[model samples]
Target: MTDKSRKPVRKAVFPVAGLGTRFLPATKAVPKEMLPIVDRPLIQYAVDEAREAGIEQMIFVTGRGKSAIEDHFDISFELEATMRERGKDMSALDGTRLAPGHCAYVRQQEPMGLGHAVWCARDIVGDEPFAVLLPDELMWGKTGCLKQMVDAYQEVGGNFISVLEVPRDEVSSYGVIDPGKADGALTEVVGLVEKPKMEDAPSNKIVSGRYILQPEVMRTLENQGKGAGGEIQLTDAMARMIGTQPFHAVTFEGRRFDCGSKTGFVEATLALALEREDMAAQVRQIAARLLRG
Candidate 1:
């Protein structure tokens, strides 16, 4: 039973305006979010996760070269016709299409930070608590990360960010949380430090891309100044809302692959390939052969 006292999270925002410079050459023409994990693109995994969480609408904050993403969601009349005529098993594209009016897209004019990208969708999001899922982070489990966060949000819903414990040595690469108290999977978030030094990190727990944030934070981002890499940082804005609202970090119980990096992308592809019933045996043999070579 969902708590009726708190507002239900019906919308989700996806910030996909990044330049993808890290994966350059490949990302030169292709958007990084369109890159594949197994057979599905990163954006597909993110959208599927959002859908699993019962998100009513998906709002994508895209950039100039992101038209491919819009086309990917649209019905491919020619391709479908060909498949149908050939009598091929087109069941593979089952979950790929979304109903009209279910999706909305807005352009992020410049390469501003995450905060700015999210701010661009303020009018569409309009006065409701919403979820943010970054496509670069591929979260894998029986239960999707956003669904897990949404479940937690329903019970105690002020603000929730999905988090997971990373190695202490690698904590400097992520935004670490200052935990106040723990209640099962929920922990009171006292503070958030974006990429803190090893000695300054409050805990090994790092913030995942999944967030269920109150709409009021958009106001904070409205006046937010550049921080960290001189880009308007979303973490800084989120920190401001902590003391005033119920801020908690829900610990994720599954694996997270940083698809933004080459190593992580390869690892996720290999990991997911091994889980497929159709090709698991072949993938294992190939992996073993590569090791021997």
Candidate 2:
């Protein structure tokens, strides 16, 4: 049973341990989470979203060769001094700064899986329902997707995941939800199937990368065995908590870009660039030319 007055989600976990094998040579040295979408790194966007949702502590589950991510969050006095000296706007750095005691990082140590990566931060996230935002999933909306989910979590206290409607045929690519009653954008989730066959899928609604989960899920992952992809699947552990907890899916009222893929990254970059006043005209011209050619 969930605590009727559950602690608000004040912490967020970022599982940034993936090797990003998809981006190849570019990611050979650069952590893929450091890849810039428009002007901000993918990780920054996720962090900004977490901050918007009132996340006071930012926890990162990282692996080898990911020190750049840590450095990215740390304050660089020299850089700030240099920017000040050069008269560059320091406002750009506003969202990147996490107060001294607000950020924490834990090493994943091995390439286990998302569930394992999340479990790595169990200590820091102790006893509180926390948010998990995959940097690879770049979401754009008036209000951050996590913020939207946080609002919903406050209403119907329990574990909640951000979901989106995908094509029926594409259901197998995601963790499909068995939806129950619906109230506005919130849906009661009775079941979850990870990467089910199209015919086996319960609904077209699929879990996105954002989640507000209870700490008990960490205990579930403690003895969880490998599921789909031979990794300790987070969805599998989450599935077990459906009936035990008040699990629900909050449909994201935003555009989500799967920046883990090259195509999605390019689309996100173009889409974001086109939204910027400084770059929109130039981007539109280039896009028009490319389309014409």
Candidate 3:
């Protein structure tokens, strides 16, 4: 099938080059993306999500102190040998290992902004539509959130962003979209504003961490001016793509946690643990007892 006939999303870019200062001591040596929600690191969730969406090539934009992120995906020969000695199943280790060419890594070098980090992958991404997932934003849904948007891209065929309705008063904290029309969960985006005030927001809907962006966005980000934070914001680059490209916001059916925040991190851990059949009962009872105390 041609590029348009088939899904245009064959690649995915993961912007994980952050310093992760919020987590401090633990993150001093360990990248925050390596921090576990329960059993998997934060970046693993984003990788798993992308793989589920049929993403063939996984590109990670990394920075200093992010070597653990690379080592995590590499084969653990010693660990696998130990597991084999104990008769552990190999099926559980399938997706966790990268086979030579399946994954690629590039450095962001400096902490310019999200836009610049994304721009670092332009050469690798080439000229095809790719998905972007922020590891810090943990999204939980029946189906992986990225998978849901990939399913939508098949029908809509343009830049698709995972959108969610945030409270009006809280809109200023996120990049808000100026919605044009709604067809069930998908909303046509006429314009996008970067963290506008509650009253000035185009709509209550805010752009979440999941995105299926066109390759052209990379070109836009290359020369994009600094926005809001005196850094080249990815939202600013995306906003410039309006009219020239088809932009739509997809309302996800999932629970998204800003795990970069302390509260959100704890909540994600608890929620994910509760979803596990093995840990559900014990974790729930402990939580209940703790609440009583």
Candidate 4:
């Protein structure tokens, strides 16, 4: 799967149009992507991952009430002025701005599906190969998941999806990959099955919501084929491109927290807080104290 003739992945498309129904009232006014794992929002982690992967432009497929996401990446004049007056260090806000042209927002008008959300950004993505990062899936590591995928994409130059081995029983909640051959972290993806029953799953390696896809996938999504819950599933579109192009998966070499769920969110909060030197000791004490009750 070594084809280096493909275009460099410069832009990243973030599908953020979902209603975030899983989070309920917390997400009623706020976009799920805005929910903070610690001090940083989920979308910030995703944007940072894309930036680390050398992605130049960010295409956010957003919906109504998603303006906070746009605001998150934009420069706030008042806040900066206040920080300046208060003699606060501005270094913390250094990576917040994406420049003007670096960020583009497209509206996904309806609650379609991941495929439709991605397709909504087609015009912005153009003909070049691009990356996709699902913000809710917080992938933490020394080298970000998208960066790892980009490195693999450079060698393989087809389509790469970040994967991680979950338990077989948990496969029903995710898109499982039918593996062909494995070479270290990279595996030849023979097929993709979206949310298969546990007994029918091909492998426990579930798609981890980070992707480096060729532009051709946009064409497949344009057809709007429905599968697995009668929605235009992205896995179905990627599955069609399986043999036609090189499709592979990188078993992510990092911790992933599914921030969309309450338990996963709490786990991520604690885990990430424990990573910070400033918060680790206090957080550990708080956890120990709570457990003693």
TM-score of each: 0.97, 0.97, 0.95, 0.96
Displacement of residue 232 (Cα, Å) in model 4 is: 0.9
Clash pairs for candidate 3? none
**lDDT by residue for model 1 (1-293), tens:** 22432688989999999989999999999999999989998999999999999998999999989888988888899999999999989987876787899899999999889999999999999988899999999999899999998898888888889899988999999999999999998999999988888888999999999999898989999998998788888899999998988899999989999999999999999999999999999999999999999
Q: After superposition, how far is residue 11 of candidate 3 from its true place, in Å?
A: 0.8
Tell me each candidate's RMSD, in Å, in order.
1.7, 1.2, 1.8, 1.5
Number of backbone clashes in candidate 3: 0
Which stretches of model 4 miss by more than 4 angstroms?
1-5
Query: How accurate locally, in lDDT, is each candidate?
Result: 0.91, 0.92, 0.88, 0.91
Per-residue lDDT tens digits for candidate 4, residues 5-36, read 37899999999988989999999999998888
Number of clashes found in candidate 1: 0
Q: Write the per-residue lDDT of candidate 2 for residues 27-110, one digit (tens) a residue.
A: 999999999998999999999999999999999999899999989988999999999999999998987778898999999998
Error of 4 at 143 (Å): 0.8
State how far residue 181 of model 3 sits from its true place (Å): 1.2
Candidate 4's error at 70, in angstroms? Answer: 1.0
- What is the RMSD, in Å, between candidate 2 and the native fold over all Cα? 1.2
